[model samples]
Target: MVAPALILVILVTLWPVAQSFYNSLFDYRLTDPSRSERFTQSNIDLERYATEYFYISRDLEDLSAQAPDDETAQAVNDIQTEIEAFHSELIEMDGLEEQYGEVDEMIASFTAISDRDLKYAEVDNDWAEGYKDFLAASNEELIALSEGAPEEDFSTTAGNVAGTLDTINSAVIESNFIGLSNYSRYLQDARMWQSLLNTFIFTIASVAVELVLGLAIAILINRVFIGRGVVRASVLIPWAIPTAVAAMMWGFLYDGQTGIVAHYFEQFGLINDASVLLSTANGGMFSVIFADVWKTTPYMALLLLAGLQTIPGSLYEAAEVDGAGKWQQFWKVTLPLLKSAILVALLFRTLDAFRVFDLIYVLTGGGPANSTESISIYAYITLFSQQNFGAGSVLSVIVFLCVALISTLFIKFIGSDLFEGRSR
Candidate 1:
């Protein structure tokens, strides 16, 4: 039973990490048609290439006719002849003439090509490289011809011809498999480092405050009280609210002018002024940390409360009988008994605080100079906003590694004995 369960766990947990790591190896993006797919071999986007080729051939014939001098007309005709030769070679390779003709007709009729088999076809790697080199050289030659053309009106046509060659050049999809380049570039990026630093600072500050406040609340509620249930329920209101909603509420409270919370803080000199809280770098970081502490402290208290409940009441009574004061009883009995719970709470909160996105995203949008940007927010912007999948996956893999490291540290230093004792 455990073996099957373990296999399922591995599948669910590690599969996405594996997939992300694989994607990080490629230069994948949605905007670039040639690089949209991860190609393992040299290939051509035949539909796009054929369409471009058809236009280039027609334009070249018109350019040859429009030339001002015999020398210029012969030069234009030479380029046309070379393009025809290349086209013949391309279509004849592995009998692609039928597919090429079909794609050409599709373009002529202004029909959208939907068939994958007709769109992408594998080509010899050497042939593809040579063709790309020729296209680049041809573009340069066309630019020179346009600049030196005796007729200014004909220069525009030559420039158009060069531009069309560029489109055809881009249609040849090369392999986007650039293993580890994205990671290497990001490792040296200062923005990446700064985002990581901001994340660590936020995580440590919020988790530390939450731990202390949570422990205190747990102790307070553990005693006999007249309305314990009501107090307990009230304590959880902040934590129970949806994180985005809480963030929005905090945003209003942090507003510079009319916000009650910011006004009071300004009066107390806790900040330089009311507006600075959400507008300045240090103030922004402080506002996010304070908001996070307020929202998540109750969750920490709940976790610690469970641990507090499990401490046998008889032990505290025994400590009291031995002349131990309430403070001493807590120090000697409660603290020792709650070690495992504290460790577990820290592990969960630290992980949650590290991956924080929605709270900070809604609150600050990592704005005012990206001073409060977390790694996850940075990843979100990179992956979705910028549409740079290769770079985005690098940030994602880094976040995963950081989470795994935090988990490992907690288990090794604090959770080892707890698990060992349970096993025994």
Candidate 2:
């Protein structure tokens, strides 16, 4: 039983981390065609090359007609001849002619080329380099020709020639494998460090407040009252709300002009202005922490309340019989007995708060100069928004390390307490 559970845990947790670690060793981005793949050797994206070359050939013929002088027309024709010579040799490689024909047909029909064998072809490293250098020189010369051309049509044709060359240039794939460079670069980045600091501050502050408030509420609701059940259920409503919905709700409440919460805070002098809550650095941090405490405190209370009920009533009776007052009984009997529960509650809340994302994201979007941007939000931007998979995976691995450390510390320091709670 334990073996199956452990295997499942490893598969879910460690497998993704291993994959990310592997990807972080490369320089990969979805936006750049050449560096998009993690290639170990010289390769060609034949689908891209053939399609762009097709356009380049047609554009060069058009450019020769638009040339302002005989000399310029000859120069354009000569460059086209050189490119075609290089391309002819490239297609003559083993099995590439057939692949090129298929790719060109696919391009003509506007079909997506999904076959790897047709899309990419391995080539000699030296030949690939020499070809790329020729294309680069051609591009530079075309740019000069564009600027010096007298006629508007000649200039436009020259500029298009350079751009089409750029598209063809993107077909060459060099090895992007650079192990540990992404990690080293980010370790030196100041913004990354600041985001980590923000995560810690948000986690510590919100969890501390929730612990105190949750304990107080737990103790209050644990007592017998006319509507104790109703009070306990009401207390859980905040925690029951979805995190994203709660964040949007708080966004409105923290708005400057029309928000009741902001207006009251300004009137009470808690803030100098109504708009500052979500618009300033300190204000943004405070708003996120405040909103987190409000939403998660009930969860903490419920955990404590479970532990509180486990303590035997006879212990409190015995303490009272020994002349222990209410305060004395709470300190000597209640607190000592509730230690395990408090530790468990703190561990759970600390881990959850440290990984906070959607709450701060939907509320402030990590704005007001990213004062409230947690490490998770930063990772999300790097991964999806920027499409830099290598750097994004590095950030993700860092978050995983931090979470693992937090878990290790909790288990190392309070393992006995946790075990005791479990036994009870």
Which candidate wins on TM-score?
1
Which residue pairs in candidate 2 have backbone atoms (N, alpha carbon, C) closer than 3 angstroms, thus clashing?
A: none
**Which residues of candidate 1, in runs, are more than 4 Å off?**
1-14, 55-74, 92-102, 108-110, 151-157, 323-327, 414-424
TM-score of 1: 0.88
The stretch of ten residues in a row with the least summed lDDT in candidate 1 is 415-424
User: Candidates' TM-scores?
Assistant: 0.88, 0.80
lDDT of candidate 1 over 184-247, digit per residue (tens): 9999999999999999999999999999999998898787879877877776898888989999
Model 1, residue 203: distance off in Å is 0.7
Residue pair clashes in candidate 1:
none
Per model, how many backbone clashes are there?
Answer: 0, 0
The 0-to-1 C-alpha lDDT of every candidate, in the order given, reads: 0.89, 0.89
